[model samples]
Target: PPLFRRYQVNVLVDHSESKGAPVVYEDHPTYNNLIGRIEHIAQMGALVTDFNLIKPGALHRANGGYLILDARQLLLQPYAWDGLKRALRSREVRIESLSQVLSLVSTVSLEPEPIPLDVKVVLIGERLLYYLLYQLDPDFGELFKVEADFNEEIPRTPENNLLYARLIGTIARKEGLRPFDRGAVARVIEHSARMADDAEKLSIHLLSTADLLREADYWAGVAGNGVVTADDVQRAIDAQIHRADRLRELVQEEIKRGTILIDTTGERVGQVNGLSVIQLGNFAFGRPNRITARVRLGKGEVVDIEREVELGGPIHSKGVLILSGFLGARYAAERPLSLSASLVFEQSYSGVEGDSASLAELCALLSSLAEVPIRQSLAVTGSVNQHGEVQAIGGVNEKIEGFFDVCKTRGLTGEQGVIIPATNVQHLMLRQDVIEAVKAGQFHIYPVQTVDQGIELLTGIPAGERDEEGNFPEGSINQLVEARLIELAEKQRAFAAPRKEAGGEEEEIKEEEGGDERTE
Candidate 1:
């Protein structure tokens, strides 16, 4: 006894459910948006409502499924986060608009029955948002017991490379775009690694890669190619660079037009080029700044011009202070360091921050004191401690490439180079052309561990250490700095001696005058 000859099932995804998932991405997540709001109809100049007029919100529609919310958006809305928590905790959704909850509306509204909730709430946001919720909202921990952390990059292995090629193939087929050949896939993977800022890892930003693929496909079609080739991928990358590089070009233009004074072919005593990375939106580029130092006879202090005008950040100020400490410890242990050094980034009008230039600043200060010429063919980056040891810095690749580009513009003299901390060698994932230049002796990279090593490389002079009698070796850079500091101290003493003598004479004359007046 069959109940029916044929049976069929009809399943409909809520039209609002994006990407064919029962998940709701609450972009604005207002109280009325997260919970249902009651609609009203004006009849005879009065408000009226019915059960059919009740509109369901995200919570109602996402019942028995997953509800995705951006924690930042949810918190930005007034009472929306708390309302969502209440629903999740109570396992029921009460349709209450913000006006009703705040008692702002005087007109009558329908009170829809609460719908039982049985759905998983997933919050997608930064780590700061999650930490804030855990610290501020007690129920957040109880509700979100499970956490899924995503890595920014994945390891670049043969297996992963094959998988990534397959992913690109699938995307190309799905989007009805020209297929990418092996060379194009390889180039894209290399670009992905560059995006991650690591040679060993590939970026997980699939959307960005997909966009690149589509653009490459368009260029391939324009060139009348049947498939996307490596040249197409390279052109797409070049176009992206051309589009987002206006500011970089302007900076380079300023450098070339003599608006920003950076020498690429000579040597100066108290100047060195320092590297810094500027982030504009999602694009970041590095530029070299001319850091100069002037030293004179005064109390031992390193005056940071950027900090004086409030352009330098706390870390930069700290680095300058550490420069003072290093001078005191290394050169002034026995004699008073009667030197005042002023450091400035020449021609920089905007706010300058970061301690990555500390090494360059110290090199400039030392050059000013020792009167040793630092090669303009070279630029330097890294932070230095009180012990004068070079420390690693961020954006090693960008910093190196920045100076390289500036030098390349002026023509690579085969002697141009950049000195970086030795520890940062592992982080080197430079461009192929730069690598070729290095290999062909058109450019160079010097890795230094201590201030001694860096100073030697910068000035082509040895930074001699103290002997058994605490005296620097004859004719060394350190000896010259020490001798200069001694001369300044002697000059300071001579100047103060005359001032003290004049003051004593005035006191004696005042006493004699008082005695003569009393006698009269």
Candidate 2:
């Protein structure tokens, strides 16, 4: 079919292709619909599953010009990849029956007849499909050399934000409601960032976005206002939360199990660990929190827990930065350090390694040994530096909200709060409802400029006065970990990544230009 001229841009934000078969029997009730559906499904050039129902050689007869194959489906089918490879290699196309699938030589021997095919093979799938083929298949470069990458989000700059604002306005007006305030538009963009993984494409999945839009409509109607204020956005969030039956149960369970700890009564010694995670969208990930590890001035400040625990993730890079920073700043004296230590989640996973948690971990460690109690109800999430400065962490909204949900479920004590990196304050787009809750003292969010500041905020204690020598009043977990980090840094030159400097060759990534896949 020719491309629809002047059609609005349609983004396909589907990832289901990585796992299962494409839905073939789509919605259709009328005879016209049935005919159209059948024809379209047939044009996919697939071997019909139920041969008894279809006419002989129907797919071959129909999709002669184009070939459509599900990447996963074809891969799962026995000998499918080989058969497709053979067809492309021979410059021929064949739709073999189940029985004829394995009869290789008799079907086509020694350069017999090449099925001349000007076929366009379309693999309806995820980017991973093509990526896997490029890596493992030697002859992949020869077949189906085309690619189509879709945008998952759009630019969130002021200009496009205004356009998005207009779209929101249109929705408001269509529902016979009021327009949105300018602040509301900015809030939406911030929410869009949280929705889209801060990507250029706002990835709050279409379904989620549609749901939000609908709820926004309801709020506007309820408020009896002509425009949707930031308040209405809050209302929609609260309404959505109220609908989450399972989440409600899970939070209660965590509370009953004492897994959701609250307000810091006081600080312990020698423990710290922190982690942060982002959701695909709203309440996607529960609020990110910190882990703490405490060391008694020795026993190695360098916690290569991942190497020990075999934890690996994309976020490890940030963790190393935090660890290294602590070592350089506190242990610069290269003093011999030996201190017993223990580090665990304030609220976390058994298998974890995401850099954002490093700050939390450091804080926990600092608080424990420093004997400074961290706030029990306050959860912190971010990455930190050796200099103790806070760095922006991803998924700030989801993380904050995640903790909020847990606290809410546990029966929000007035002290319930979330602590985030000072740098991440700009990213704050708490649901209008959540913001209101904060205002009502039902929840709280605190931003910290440094690990010290975060710790101070967490434990309700001033981070303690630094001495002339610049230490955490000695005997503190911060001082101990820093000392250990310095010792470890001196003893080992940590190889951060696979680079030539570390004796590893660089990986070359070749991206396809336009729709033409250039094989390397």
* TM-score to true structure, per model: 0.89, 0.60
Q: Which stretches of candidate 1 lie over 4 Å from their true place?
A: 1-28, 41-46, 76-79, 132-145, 157-159, 505-520
Model 2 lDDT, full chain set? 0.57
Runs in model 2 lying further than 4 Å from the true structure: 1-69, 94-98, 104-115, 158-193, 197-201, 207-248, 256-260, 264-283, 287-294, 297-325, 346-349, 385-389, 405-416, 439-444, 459-520
- In candidate 2, position 479 carries an lDDT of 56
185: Cα error in model 1, Å: 2.3
What tens-digit string does per-residue lDDT give for candidate 1 at 37-96?
Answer: 777788899887666557777887788778898888888888988898899899998987
Among the numbered candidates, top TM-score falls to 1
- Displacement of residue 281 (Cα, Å) in model 1 is 1.2
Worst 10 residues of 1 by lDDT: 4-13
**What RMSD, rounded to one decimal, does every model reach?**
5.2, 18.2
